[model samples]
Target: MKINSKKVTVQKSSQALCEYLSDVKNFEALMPDNISKFELIRDDAFVFALKGMPEIALEVKEVEAPHKVMLGALSDKIPFQLTANIETINANTSQVELVFEGDFNPMMAMMIKSPITKFLETLAGNLEQIQ
Candidate 1:
């Protein structure tokens, strides 16, 4: 199975948005209950608990702060990863778009998509709440 996604744009400065996304620690606080016990391993890398699932751990494989972040699931059950890419259109304006892809069992694959979408929506809302 393949994971695909996208997101709406944000009206924020690129540098400012990058600054906000620079620290992995900040993201943990913004994540909703679907995620729990979040931790940053190194720089933009991390391992976090995913709720309502198999207690899966997520790790950041690649990242460019507010511009983009690629994450992978470390769970045996799910073989999926997500790449969140953000762009700054103009001063005081930015946007976040995501691409996801993975190989998983039929039921698990179906289960992940919608929740992932919801999580992204929730994440966006939380981000907007800041600044």
Candidate 2:
């Protein structure tokens, strides 16, 4: 399953946003308010739990400077990759897009599509306010 978030314009430059996201500690500001637990185990790894979901470990898999950052699930329960792409709009503005790609059975995909879509959209919208 693959879901793409709506693009959002942010007041910060791509470089600034990239710098912020490059540090896992700054992710707290971008997380959903319902998050029950969050821990940064290393510079590139962390564990977090949502209101009713099992704990999930995520690791930053790759980064392309101010262009893109890719993160992947480190838990077997959920196999997925989340990518944040940043595009420079001007010296002080950027366009950001989020994509979630998950490996799910057809039945599971049908059931969680709406919720996952909403989650991705919310994440993107929240990220827009990072400046």
Candidate 3:
């Protein structure tokens, strides 16, 4: 299934945003208060676990300067790809949105759709409040 976050305008420039996202460590700042585990594997990869979920390892798989970034999980248990699309509005401002796609069967998709959408919204909202 595919889910997209509402585009949010933030004070950060695209370059700065990309720089911030390219570092896997910064993802902790975007996570919710329930994050139970966050372990860095490399400068661009880490494994994390939420309140009730199994641990998942993710890496910043790809990045296009000042525009796009793609993060992918290493575990096959929950196959998914997440992309962040950034648009420059000015030198001091930009818009950011997230697209999440997961490979899951019909029943699994139904069960996860709501939480994934909520997670996307939370992620987008965090972008605005992040320094």
Clashing pairs in 2: none
TM-score of 1: 0.72
TM-score of 2: 0.93
> Could you give candidate 3's per-residue lDDT for residues 1-131 as a string of tens digits?
99999999888999999998898898888887788999999988999888887788988889998899999988878899889999999998999999999899999999989978988888899988877
Q: Give the TM-score of candidate 3.
A: 0.95
Q: Mind giving the per-residue lDDT tens digits that candidate 1 earns over 1-131?
A: 65444455666676676666655677787788767667776776566666755454666666676687777776656677776678878888887766677886778768777877776677777766666
lDDT of 2 by residue, 13-79 (tens): 8988877777778777788888899999888989988898778788899889898988899886879
Pairs with steric clashes in candidate 1? 3-100, 12-92, 12-93, 13-92
Better of 1 and 2 by TM-score: 2
RMSD of 1: 3.0
lDDT of 3: 0.90
The regions of model 2 sitting more than 4 angstroms off are none
On lDDT, the leading prediction is: 3
* Preferred candidate (TM-score higher): 1 or 3: 3
Candidate 3 lDDT at 50 equals 81
Clashes of each: 4, 0, 0
- C-alpha RMSD (angstroms) for model 3: 1.0
